[model samples]
Target: MAEEKPLTVVTCTAPVNIAVIKYWGKRDEELILPINSSLSVTLHQDQLKTTTTAAISRDFKEDRLWLNGEEADVGHPRLQSCLREMRRLARKRRGGSAGAAAPLSLAYKVHVASVNNFPTAAGLASSAAGYACLVHTLARLYGVEGELSEVARQGSGSACRSMLGGFVQWLMGERPDGKDSIAQQVAPETHWPELRVLILVVSAEKKPVGSTAGMQTSVDTSLLLKHRAEAVVPERMAQMIQFIQQRDFEGFGQLTMKDSNQFHATCLDTFPPIFYLNDVSRRIIALAHRFNAHHGKTKVAYTFDAGPNAVVFTLADTVEEFVEVVKCSFPPESNGDQFLKGLPARPASLSKELLSAVVLEPVPGAIRYILLTKPGPGPQPLDDPNLHLLGADGLPCPRA
Candidate 1:
């Protein structure tokens, strides 16, 4: 290894997405292939996202990874898959014999450093953002590009969705090689410019049961999961797509809520049972329904993943009213918790009658904060070196 070897580095940021059509089970564990195609709205980078930097150099003796300012397991199968695939593609596309990808140091080892703007493993899909950033950033360094979501899918199933903007669907393709299973854009960010996603961070602490293990158990044990994947998903996916195309918030909200409920239902149907939603989650569900009923339509929709947080979806015109409903109902500053954050919106007062009609018990402590955001772009390059997460020494840098 040459101590003075120059390095090639690239850094990029990838947004986090919340599944409206949840992916709960996997048919192939090794490849991280999903049993059903899932759809999600890619969030704006204003709130939750992951930033990663990939540095390749002859001086580096081994490949290493750092996540959120801490050294992570570079040997992780998914991480290795992303790294290996990038190198393979680079070698095949650019590198020549003896693994020379370019005129320079294409065969050199890489050091990856990633950091998330949000909590990890709290069912906010940190892995999705992290892996997407890794794959995108690595591709930038390797000079291999075009539809890299398929490669990202090998790392984390949902991570593929982050590869595109706005509404995305990970098609559960028929091919066994998993080549056809890729993320595709359903609609661009401009399609639903009025739409907003308000994430209620219930518990930022690491999930007691990770999605990987929980979904694995569901695949092995839950017959409901099997039925849902085989019978329920295809039709639901079609309906969801149509709803988005038509901008049918009422229909979309109804289906989104139903799909989330069914996803959790499959969780209960699993042996020994897994509960992602607690009292707070259940209350949020009720509130969404009652709030919609008060207006006689679905003004906002609520969805939950394999964790307790609630993702509330609504339109821009209605966002302020709903945010006030949530704040007045839950009180963000209560108990000294500064929980309300995201998209600047004025507080619209909820009627005393409306508040009474909501008929929900308040549990402010259960919710950590509310993140306000909208749909935005996919993985984007950081042109400025000031934003890079890796140091010139090919090591992790202290976060600003």
Candidate 2:
């Protein structure tokens, strides 16, 4: 009897990172090359992350994907690029084996299954987390090992940093080919256990300008972005790294807020002026400043990405105070019935439904709800067979 063909399965997870020192203005858009170095902290996976399982089986017809339990287009260049790159790396493995026995060069077709803990198109860098998870999982399934930072860079520039846990830096390598452009860790999650991050989801709607388009706009027209890349960022990168190393919350907090402001300033300075933040976002920033000023130093540091959502960072000691202060800053929602019904704050696992009632925190209806988290770890494979996309026979399941 002929032996059954081999099958391969790989699973990986990635956490979302909020840039303390932002990455804006790409030098090469195709390669996702950043004009300046940036730093970010990986958020807790239980709070926000993407887990993906990639498998290869001869039984599969073509490359396919199921994202968050729904069929998604795998032909997208972003998805195609990651799939092709992982396959290339897999082909180069020193000792390749699908199910043992033979040194298989390429034995099966690919299938990917992924899920995100947070809402998609919510301006939470879901794409960064998604792509990073896909590349890492595919690499593991094919018995291929390479520099994770390099693999992630092909997915997303900010994604390279998501490959690692704790505080990471995406070094703006000057090399044109982007070999030197990879993420390096400044500190591990354990290094700063006292820090806490609260994600205030201002809106679940997709940002009008995606990061790629926003970066391009800033690069082409914003003179402030030019100045930031050349003069401002290099100095900030060094100080930010030192701040992380020393666990200096005040120093880190100041730099984070400043960099976030500068990033959006470049957005406003764009030719047509892409506005990612609205009145609600402005109110949150102002409230943070007021609270910190009242305390005589920074108690809570707030940063906004390409969207209106606010990521508030505070030392564990000050979180409750900051949250309370922010709650009072905005007027109650105008809708009488809805205004009285406070937004629920609970873990996602405990709740079956997505938080639908939008409570106006400080800026009425500005924030959807807040996700509480802390520094977290990098990718890990899930042990549950239920999470596997491949069947016991090492073939893609039709249901997957």
User: TM-score for each prediction?
Assistant: 0.95, 0.87
Which stretches of candidate 1 lie above 4 Å from their native place? Answer: 1-5, 95-106, 333-337
Tens digits of per-residue lDDT for model 2 on 308-383?
Answer: 8899898877766555444445444554233211222321121111111112343555555666789999877787
Task: Tell me the tens digit of each residue's lDDT in model 1 across 1-400.
Answer: 3224588778999999999999988888878789999999999997878988988888899998888888988999888888888878876775444653353355578898988888899889899998899899888887786779999999999999999989999998878888899999999989988889999987888888888899999889999999999999999999999999999999998999999999999999988799999888888888888999999989999899989999999999998888777776676546433566877877677788888888466765667788999999899999899888788898877772
- What local lDDT does model 1 show for residue 170? 97
lDDT of each: 0.87, 0.77
Cα RMSDs, all models: 2.5, 6.2
Index of the highest-lDDT prediction:
1
Clashing pairs in 1: 95-100, 95-101, 96-100
